[model samples]
Target: MSQDLPTTSYALLGLLSFGDDLSGYELKQRADRTLRFYWVSPAMSQVYTELARLTKLGLVRAREDTTAPTRSTRRFQITAAGRRDLQRWLSSATVEFPALKHPIALRLLMGHLAGPETSVTLLEDYLGLLAERRAELQAVRDSLIVDPHSPVDRFRYPRMVADWGLDYYESERAMVVELIRRVAATDT
Candidate 1:
């Protein structure tokens, strides 16, 4: 591993920004629920491996949770050195978002290479998936009675996440249907 650390290293550092000593599981949940909208997750092995590497580099420190009977249970904390490293990483380079290589985008780009029927089938399948996702999001959102001042809502990052997902999926479903109509008209 390079001394500079990978993208996930900064992700771990960013979680530490919340000012809590967290177990790996807690860290994973936070990343999944909150950071996932704008960040990628490393594999479970990669997370643990990076945590170990961060410990070795004095950027992170792990201590046994004495409150737990099992010594294997540990929580990690960011050191002053870790904070400095994170600051340096942030200042040194611009973060590059990963290029989207979505199946829909690929199908759209090359749909002309396929038969009209094939294109319609692909678009319909994608539309079905989007509709399913939108339904799930709607149900989840409907279940939540929004209380802006609720302490629970304040920390429920995933609710905000679900809201964004609902809007995006709805938009995508509409766009795909319109594109399909255009494709059909053009084929005639």
Candidate 2:
């Protein structure tokens, strides 16, 4: 069953496992808030399409929410089958190395043409942007609830992942600073 669905489908199932009956719009919002840090957040249209496919596969159950003040809205929750499939995929899937697509690195490789000044400027600008992103991710890390007394903290893993992202950003910032210095020292 897992082989039939794309990875995004599994991502949605994982989102729903948090125990909220969410509409497609809400799902997109959640993805934007969380997935953007580490993974590509699926477009709104993709969210709807995946939801429809999951519904057809009996992995998700959609029901009309009549309590809405305006027109009825459809909210979705993961079915038992979805949970089983997610668990199976998590346990059995072979993890692949993360693909790096660093635009800055690509540009830096051809820095001879752009000259040292341009390369220094590029690396400096990246530092500012990295700081901004790091702060935003830090805010997200701060917002997660971690209860030490509880044997099971649903947010424990999320907090760990957020910390990992924060560390990654810090490492990138240090590397960019070094690159800036190196470029500025270049003869050309």
Candidate 3:
């Protein structure tokens, strides 16, 4: 775990989680499937750039294709060195989540500058967004429960947690909609 391993290098480890060697395209697709919820996929250029750096650092090894006659399609595998580096990083690294700075909180803080109508409209808009998001999460929860192969669905406790989240969002959305209706009805 060289502290010098750039942030993008962790993503290469993520690609290896499937326990298969992958061309950069295959790696990118796998990363998209698993990491899209948390991390952005590196652009094709960024993937190549990271591969070059990781190879230079001895964290990943590449093999040239003799028959294909294209260098861009060369495949990579995690080196023994790379696996050791990854395990060391996992054991030694401290996890630090980025700061939480909610845009909605910022808007609420500055909202007095907006007149009552604007404030009400903003709240309504926010409610709409929340409802839409709740629906999306609901779909995710449903799919997880019904899709037998979903990783989360295999564990009973995590499935319960997902159900709880689905209920929580639906409850919150209803409460917010009701509160908005009450506020809009009240006269000064």
Q: Which of the numbered candidates is closest to the native, going by highest lDDT?
A: 2
Question: In model 2, what is the error at residue 67, expressed in angstroms?
Answer: 1.1
lDDT of 1 by residue, 43-89 (tens): 66767887888888888889888896766677988888889888888
If the candidates were sorted by their TM-score against the true structure, best first, what order would they fall in?
2, 1, 3
Clashing pairs in 3: none
Whole-model lDDT per candidate: 0.76, 0.89, 0.67
Model 1: how large is the Cα RMSD against the reference? 4.6
Q: State the lDDT of candidate 3 residue by residue for 49-161, as single tens digits.
A: 88888888787888775666564457888888788888787787789784455565467566567645665677688788877766765555555454566664353543575
User: For candidate 2, what is the lDDT?
Assistant: 0.89
lDDT value, residue 20 of candidate 2: 96
TM-score per candidate, chains pooled? 0.69, 0.93, 0.58
TM-score of 3: 0.58
lDDT of 2 at 36: 81
Whole-model lDDT, candidate 1?
A: 0.76
Candidate 2 lDDT over residue span 103-173, tens digit each: 88898999978889888888888888899989999989998978788788889899999999999999989
8, model 2: CA deviation in Å?
1.4
